[model samples]
Target: CNALNASCSDCLGNSKCMYCYTDNTCKLYPSGKIIPPSSYCALDKARWGTCLVNFEALLISMGVIGGVLLLTITGCCIYCCYCRKGKNKRYEREDAKFESQRMERKARQEERRNERRSRLDEIRMKYGLMKEDSAPYTRFDA
Candidate 1:
């Protein structure tokens, strides 16, 4: 209703006309004006000023941050997995090489021991300490 168009005769002396102005109005009161109050609404259309939060911008920022964190974590996991696989392969190769060398060293030591035993047997035979039919000396005999 237009406050200015109301007539005093229509009230039949029971009601009075009151003009609502912006100056004396409460800050929380709802106004029918299409434009918002400058105190509560920002000049920039993107913002809601001090009274409200910009949920669109807030949600978008959160999504972006979450995406970045997810990508970073994924990248780190992939890198760690790759590095661990490579390290395991390297360790296996080194272990196999070491095992082969150990086996070869054992074979060489056994050959040397056999050579020493043969030399001792030849010396015993020449000194007439053991006959051709006698059993060879053993570690337990010593």
Candidate 2:
């Protein structure tokens, strides 16, 4: 009886009521009427005991799931930002390369133009198409 922690004298005598270690009490509801010694236990169990384990498990699972979701979202955001930054840097490098190539092409074109002009001047000198002052001759007929 001491080990069982029975509340009612009948429970102690007849071994009918089961003791709950969580609340340290015995509970009994006979013929739809609650006994006084077990009333507190019954009320407490009704309010907090029925769904305690499931509630705690659900709360823990939700917290874990929320944390994982947050981590995933943050990781994806960081990855996307890094990818965009890398792409931007790549684009900048490509643009710089293209600009350098365009400048080289322009320099080559200028060199060709200069060479053609020099050749034309030389041909004019060899054919006597220019005067002594290096100006071309123009006809004036009255």
Clash number for each model: 0, 0
Q: TM-scores for all candidates? A: 0.54, 0.54
Winning model by lDDT: 2
Off by over 4 Å in 2: 1-53, 131-142
lDDT of candidate 2 over 87-111, digit per residue (tens): 9999999999999999999999999
What is the per-residue lDDT of model 1 for residues 1-142, given as tens digits with 9 covering 90 to 100?
Answer: 2333343232122222221232322132224643344554332321222213332454467789999999999999998999888999999999999999999999999999999999998998899876665567645754
**Candidate 1: segments with Cα more than 4 A from true spot:** 1-53, 131-142
What pairs collide in candidate 2?
none
- Candidate 1 RMSD computed on C-alpha atoms after optimal superposition onto the true structure: 14.5
